[model samples]
Target: MSVPSQVDLASCADEPIHIPGSIQPHGFLLFLDAAGRIEGWSANAPEILAGQLQLGLAYTTLPLPPACTDLIAECIDLLAEGEYAPAVAAVSIAGHDYDAIVHGSHGRVIAEFESRDVPADTVAMFAVKAHSSIERVRRQRSIEGLLETAVRQVREFTGFDRVMAYVFREDDSGDVVAEARRDDLAPYLGQRYPAGDIPAQARRLYVLNTLRMIADIGYTPVPLLGAPGAAPLDMSFGVLRSVSPIHVEYLQNMGVHASMSVSIVINGRLWGLIACHHMAPKRVPHAIRMAADVLAQVMASTVQSIEARSDAELVEQSAKVRTALVESLLIDEEPLDALARHADDLLAATRSQALVSVHNGKIISHGPIERETAEAIVRAMPADASDILVRDKLGEWPQDVHASVGKWVGLLGLPFDPPGGGWCLLLRTEQIEHVSWGGRPEKLAQVGPLGERLTPRGSFDAWHETVRGHAHPWEATVLANARLTQSELLRASNARRAQLDSTRAQLLAMLGHDLRDPLHSINMAGTLLERGAVQPTLGRRIQSSSNRMQRLIGQVLDMSRIDGGMGLGMVFEPLDLAALVEDVIDESRMAYPSIDYSFANPGPTCVRADGGRLGQVLSNLLSNARHHGEVGRPIVATLAREPGWAVLEVANGGAPIAQDVAASLFNPFKRSSLHNPRNRTGMGLGLYIVAQIVREHQGEIAYRHEHGQVVFTVRLPLAEMERAGPT
Candidate 1:
């Protein structure tokens, strides 16, 4: 048979399995309204109650045994008191023993009576059986051992021919991981089943009602007959709820006459099922079913404990790696550089084939991946993506992305918070999987007596499939490690930002203090000149002090622009580079008259540049030389012309820059306190501003300590007019 289209499989999930409106023939149902009136009764109720039941009649007046009536009354009282938990009791109805289960549903009460085929177990017997089973389950330390034990105990308790513990994968498909069965039966262990076998609505009901039993797959559905305009009864908690027609056909096709499933819910999620099957019609008494429910609960709890312990171990191990990475980030080195250094640790932590980091539009990889592949993979990520993405099957991804992903079939990407923060990606190569499915794992839409509808595949034989373009599934431990690493990276980035803010605060405070001295000199000189002491020395003092104040203010403004991500604005023009250098040298000579200054120019070297910014650069470099150089050494400025370029060098005699300070030489607020502490009165924005302005002019700047002197070089392209001789 041809498999159904994806649409047909999805439509199956939309069936309203919760409100089936009917139940298996083994039970009778009645729904009572808030006033105790019977608003709904199953079609089989008339024959079971000897034609004495009627809709809208009070349940208290029904012809039921005192045991059944008393249980219903108590269930009603509990509902009146806001308790909705279901209550069950053994009762004799029409001389036949039955299990009366009552529960509140949708502001009404549901009463169901299931005929008992075998004698009910005493409470003591049930307790002993449950305790022994639960103890056996709890004693198993591993999940596989625990599930194996659970299946054996359930089969022993229910006398089922086959029992299997099935576990759901991340995709909702399931695998029978453990099984206990009669020697005559074929084992379902290790057989995979597709997600369509259960459907979404069925999975939901499984969570709502943790235990379900189908006494006979071929039994007729007993539909509920209700008052006019009455809504379909909600059988979400119904133990005898009539399952989907497709599910019934599915079991028949597998040669199963009866079935029972107890949900394995871990942390409130339907993790899997303890499925039981028999070759003959088998109706398990309510007590045995309840005992199985209890055992399943214990099994779920034990599984949770085992898995939690495993995850906890991984978290502890990853925490150590994350702590080490964070500590490296706190050091003086760049954060990205630190991440590169710890790339091996990250790979080990995630157990990934490779790792890559993308920040500030730069990519750093630590594996066999080429730069182009890494760039393409990063580009394929959503621009607004902010959460961790884990993809194991590259074949399932969009076709457009496949080309970019290349041979890698798995990608785990963790995006940092606050846009443009950064991203980390872990990559894995493809690993083909040979899966053994329980059947062909497909349903077919067939035209039958009821028209076109999906039917379960009529095959139970083992089928083999070769799955390609998939990587090894990322373990829960790996995912947890990725989350932990992402959290630490965010925390470290925030801390770094905080430290930068503190540094900015200190720089501003120092700028204010440095301004006061220059401002006071200007004010005092102006007062002296106004008092008829108009000496050339006082006039020069005012001019020098005013210039100092201007330079100080310019540095502050330039720093603000750089910090705000705004580059320095420039007006490009052709100018004599030598003249600009000479003018700055003369100004600096006067500013520090006590220090020797020298200048050399190879004629007029013209370049297109921002003249004022370039002058600021020269003044800052000269001032830096005077403040740090030997007291008697000359601050030399040399300008030369190269092919299509103008080169300028500023050489100052000084001890080489400290390794620590040189690490961030052009970074803002990087003043050296090791020498001339008084000269460090200004904010350390001079060198940073110079670097920024040089970059804006399309020029190159470099610093070198060689030949017993520190040399700062700037290279700018010669202007077209300068190169072509005024053409």
Candidate 2:
């Protein structure tokens, strides 16, 4: 027989081999087939797998047990596919559905070993050992699962009466989501701890030390190293490790005598804590604690996993519901009905009792509570406050009603995106016995004196001692989800409102500017005519003003049509470029009689463009130069042909445009601060319209400044002009 390679044997050695001197004396050696069936087993397997017989028997060829055959088959399939090749599979053995390490090779099970078992008091310690290898393998799995597993392992390994995974809330509160403890202790799986209980200082210390231990609350304190005698031991803990004395006192007050805490660091910042609490005084050896710390690190990833998965599920569900609501509103135009229909589902999904309220400064409709009662509650709320919770006055309510309603207490006020329109209110009530407050009872007394006294009989009795009647007010996760939902809705509403307002503003500005220029010219002509200046020169000037007004009116019509998506029809006919330039010059001279105008055409050039629109573009550019550029400085218009296209250049001796202004010059309603006050006659749309018209003709326009002057140029494709025939 050939021997296996040393590397392969070494790899197997690194696998989950039985470690001697474990708390449990029994040892197990198991061999599984490619299908995870028991191909071979050692004599010691039965002794070690005592209570865990199901798992040991699973490896056998005998008919698989009905209880776990499917689970084993699934694991074997995963191993065969190499998905679990590098990782140990924590398979349950028979009745003992605990954790064990199973290794596989080449689609076949190679070896398996059960971790040492220990005393019930030390089961948590043994679990830690059992999970170390699996924990390491989990690092390569999902990060979120890694965190959840880490937390679960810590809780199960430390023998803490209760282990909680807590995360910080935006409101500085903390929530308990994942919890594990012995059967003797009450479950705190979904409890929420108040922010006041943790306090700012305690949280700061918890973050400083990622790992902390209160081995024995009653143990004597190790005095400070420097008591004016011996030098300090310089025993400062790791930044990820620190103990809070106040927290210890708080726990002691709660009857907890020992605790261990580790920080859950995400992206190098403290995300939350994994806290393990022991009800009775306990002492852990240094080695065991070190092992716990290592396991804690491994388990952090698992805790993160569970949180992420849970959050993803919540978000997905929320999205589905939100989509349904939004679609229903769009389709049926009945938002209230849609919300009502989903009330129970939303409440159960969010783990809160929700009340929907419609209000217009006064309550209109409410669900899950009487309208009169809701209004009274709303009226009693502080003016500036939108939400309030009263947990102390539960006994005041009518006894029959209170009994039916349960002892849960929570109040949430959701104002409409634009307040005073209509709003929503959600109230959650949990059974009263589950409520626990970490703060002093005296603090509860302080809020009791408010005139809102609770009646001691009937439904009102539940309102008495209100502080103690409610489950801890909104937890970090609940509040965060609520805020996220509200913010998204607010953002969408604001964005839509902004878009509508922008469109309205743009339309109004377009109308005012487009009509103002022609109106001004007509008014000017009428004023001049009323003065009785009938001289030949004055008559010609008045005629010119009327023509300019007519042209402006035509430009406005064309612009409106273009903006309305109406196509600009072009008449293709051979046209002289020189004539077009000359016409533009004459029109500009007439429009701005005070400015000098010049034209240059290099040769007899023929091109095709809509004569009216092309002339309007040229006239607008020249007019802009006369009004915005330096007046009295000659405006020069030039036309030339380059290889594939014709180019028209309008140059003016004017103040150079600043680089920033030049960038936005062609945008609608954009005017440089340097524009002349006397020429505020245009609505700043001349260049914008010019660019648009030119682009429609398959041409390009650009602006540049040189030698104390700014120049605008238009380039049109020569071939396109030929296809269009002419202007």
Candidate 3:
């Protein structure tokens, strides 16, 4: 990620705020000595601080009114550890209520007391309303509907004129996807805002505060005072903490007179914001903000689930298409011809408009492509272009190629020829977009009384900008497809090359290593179960991983049977690939939570194959993704179906697989590290087992490297086995 510009970055972090010598007028502050005597107090301390007496008086003797003394004393139990938490309690004295914040700093106990006249009946009312709202939000099945309900519930609870669900993008910029507003207000839905609008320091504050409010944008900030040479106080935990000036200006420019915000945080990061705006100055009760916090928890969990789901879908789609392409290549003796036969499916699987296969200095074009353009693409290809090369914009092409700007704006290059001579290029045409921003994105310089200074935009009118010279950047689904196809074609080429100089002793050398890891685990689990020390999750892992191992062994044995001129021991039955995909993702959640997954199931993709063998294929593919893919980013899996075939793909982002390794990807003993990266187990028969299974099933499996990810795919034919079909 690149650093955002400092000009637009607004943070008042360095100002001496602890000794600001003032406090928000709505609150009274007191500093206590070691013996609990009042040392210093805010100027208005006399009016609401219990009409207490002068200096050196014990603060404990000032108020004993409604059992708040015990709560205050309990707060100080951990004061030695510097626990200065806010929002301790709501204590009522003489028919009025005040919120208390008692904290310890520098061996001195400081107390802040504020009153919004917090109604006595508000808690009971809010509890009932929150319970019903939570039940309704929990009923939503899709993430879109869930978060939409969250913002609506908050809007109703807070009585704000407008409320928007603002979710952050990959670049930290935000978009308003859901909104609730009065009819008189203009809608801010679907508008994009720049990153620095809330700055870095403010983002940190949000995580700490969880919820913040500005009663009136036009009100002056009340400064907290300290001694002349004292350090500033950290008000990060203060409920009435003032906001940054730039943010206030930003709100004013948007025609908002008052605002309140709830931090929708997920796993320690600020995922998004629930922003509430009022056209008039309005103070939201503190009790309502606390209720909003409850909804934030629901939104955070839902968002995490949605992100994981999207990743799983992408993985499913990539697996489907790449697997299909690889399977097609295995059937045809001439790969170029196979490419032509599967042209339509390949294009459909990837986010591309065309495919161009260049071999022996000759170009075979498909789907609205030209020979000259294909030749130029080959010349511009990278040196080691065996891995997939993706370019979203066609910059500085030759005059002839450049002439077709909108027609061919994006390109994906997959080299098939030994070095850089042959290539398969996927193309994407330009897509024009109209963008709306909350304000003009550019900064302005004004010659004010002070020297030339950069100022925030004065107006936040809807700014429209027409964007061009771009195409839909190849998504992980298509990139994974490309990588898987590249793998298969390269493996096939290597097998053909080996035919000229192959030998026998080294043929099955890799199988010399035993598949003992799963067997060992199964043995241990069985022993423990016999001894009555049963662990369900452990037993399940042993069962699942061992079953996959058995399928792999069966696939190999079946291949050996064919090689030895013996009959096969295999069963065929129709099964839904989508169901298998869901099972794999759910298992991965428990086993490999570090890797985010996207499983895309276009529909009910079914194939006639051995269910156990296919599960092995999926298990191995996901295992490979977890070990080989990038951390933090989603590993995409895809399942696609055609007239007679089902394709499954697994794609992950990381360093591109090198040409030498990709060439031997399907051969035994060519193992990559697992998730831990330190433990190197197994005979490396995973892909070899997968390839044999695909071949026996009369389908195909392939590999490729695209968009910095290694993608593997398995393809199988769908059979018309009836309900009574035997295996």
Best by TM-score: 1
lDDT of each: 0.79, 0.53, 0.68
**Which of 1 and 2 is ahead in lDDT?**
1
lDDT of predicted model 1: 0.79
Count of backbone collisions within predicted model 1:
0
The residue ranges of model 1 lying beyond 4 angstroms of the native Cα positions read: 1-15, 19-21, 40-48, 81-83, 120-127, 223-229, 311-320, 358-364, 367-391, 395-407, 414-423, 472-673, 676-727
**Candidates by lDDT, descending order:** 1, 3, 2
lDDT of 2 at 654: 81
Worst 10 residues of 2 by lDDT: 455-464
Off by over 4 Å in 2: 1-203, 212-234, 238-287, 331-338, 341-350, 359-367, 375-409, 417-420, 434-472, 475-727
- lDDT by residue for model 3 (1-727), tens: 1211111112333433223344555656666654566555555453546366445677676864444555456556666666546536676644556676666655566677666664658756866676677777877778779878987887776789999988886568788889999998888898878776666777888787788777888876554433433334455666655565556667877889888888889889888998999999887666667778778877777777777687677667667766766665543333554577777766766757888776545456788767666666666666565587877765644455566444677887777656425577778887787878878877678753233655567777779888777778777656765777777778866664454124222334433343566677778888888898867687687877677567547645754553333434458777787898888788888777666889866766667777877777788788777766677778889887666677788998878777766766765444352223432444455676667567668787888777777778777777665222457
Estimated TM-score per prediction? 0.64, 0.34, 0.58
lDDT of 1 by residue, 1-727 (tens): 1211111122333568787767898878888887789777777774656365666678877787787777777777777766477788888776877788988877788888888767544545755776799889889899888888899898887789999999998888999999999999987888999998888888888898999999898888877777655666777888878888778878988999999999999877889899999999998888888889988888888888888898887788788888988877664324555677788877777778887787656567898888888888877777677568889988666678787777776888887634544778888888877889999998888974346887887887889999888898899788877887878887887786686788878867777787888889988887887797767788777776787788778777877776555567888888898999888888777767888889976778878888888888888888788777877888888888778878899998987887777756666666563224757455666787887788667677878899889999988889887777754
Ranking by TM-score: 1, 3, 2
Error of 1 at 502 (Å): 10
Residue 467 shift from truth in candidate 3, angstroms: 1.0
Q: Which regions in candidate 3 have their CA more than 4 angstroms from the true location?
A: 1-24, 28-87, 93-95, 101-114, 267-269, 327-332, 335-353, 357-375, 386-388, 394-407, 411-426, 447-453, 474-496, 499-727
Q: Is 1 or 3 the stronger prediction by TM-score? A: 1
Report the C-alpha lDDT of model 2 over 71-115, residue by residue, as the tens digit.
455557777466342223334454443233344444444343333
